[model samples]
Target: MRGFISLLLLTLGLCLQATGMAADKSVIAVIVTNDNPNKSISLGELKLIYWRKKTYWANGQRIHPINLPPDHPLRLQFSNSILGSTPSAQNDYWNGLYFHGISPPHVLYSDEAAIRYVQETAGSIAYADACKLDNRVKPLLWLLPNGETTTNPSFVNCN
Candidate 1:
């Protein structure tokens, strides 16, 4: 009986530890300006914009979708959560668009660059760690590990 009780306690402790570790992982927020005077974009709409399927905002302004580096953690998270695709799958999708004379969205090397580009260019959108967000741009979406939206306006950082 004593041994069983000890094992149970150990299991509970491990479960708690695992949960804490997962909670520590940062949630990334994809942001854009609210002042664009365009309709709030749905998840599908956002995917279309980022994938280059839709190239213009409702105001007829050209949309610029900024992307993270191929191997960036936020990029992987964005691909999986927003596009329901992997990095390779995203590449394939982009390739298909490129081969047909359609251009994919422009890619940036880092989150800082993406943010800077968005800040400088109207009708532009980008993602980054919530903690790094500044007054330059506004947030559009919050991505979760399970592909769900978060009500929290901040990004979570596990590191």
Candidate 2:
């Protein structure tokens, strides 16, 4: 009876572990892409690019950043992670910028549209959930729940 109880407990533990792994696997990093050959982007640089603080790639090409709808989870994640600001704050910031004739980043309605825009446009950056990522675009940074970056060295090239 003791051995049977131990086995059952171990099985339950394994099941929980598997479920946790699956949950982690569901999250993914989506990125912006450019024709330039650079392989990696620093977190600071990425933030500047997304926030319209920086408008050119490392190679001096024009930068076009795409965005998700205001309410999308990944949009909120990107804003919080990269801009260190909330959506309402960002909206206010953009409004302020716009009043000065400074246009904000272009917003898209969905992740698929954002991906397509990035793929077709040169020096474009966008974000999406990892599970939905395709081979067409590369991920630049991963945003953790704590608003810290998890840099992926493999995707620096914008390939």
Best by lDDT: 1
User: How would you encode candidate 1's per-residue C-alpha lDDT over 1-159 as one tens digit per residue?
Assistant: 999999999999999997676454456777776566743458888888877888898779988888887767777778877888867777677687787898766778877887788888888888887777778877766777666876466445544
Please report the candidate that would top TM-score against the real structure.
Answer: 1
Task: Kindly report which residue stretches of model 2 are placed more than 4 angstroms away from their true locations once superposed.
Answer: 1-28, 153-159
Per-candidate Cα RMSD to the true structure, in Å, reads: 7.3, 8.8
lDDT by residue (tens digit), candidate 2, 49-146: 77688998767889888878776666766776677786777777788788788788788988788878888888887777665667778776666545
Clashing pairs in 1: 24-158, 26-156, 26-157, 26-158, 27-156, 31-139, 31-140
Provide TM-scores for the models: 0.75, 0.72
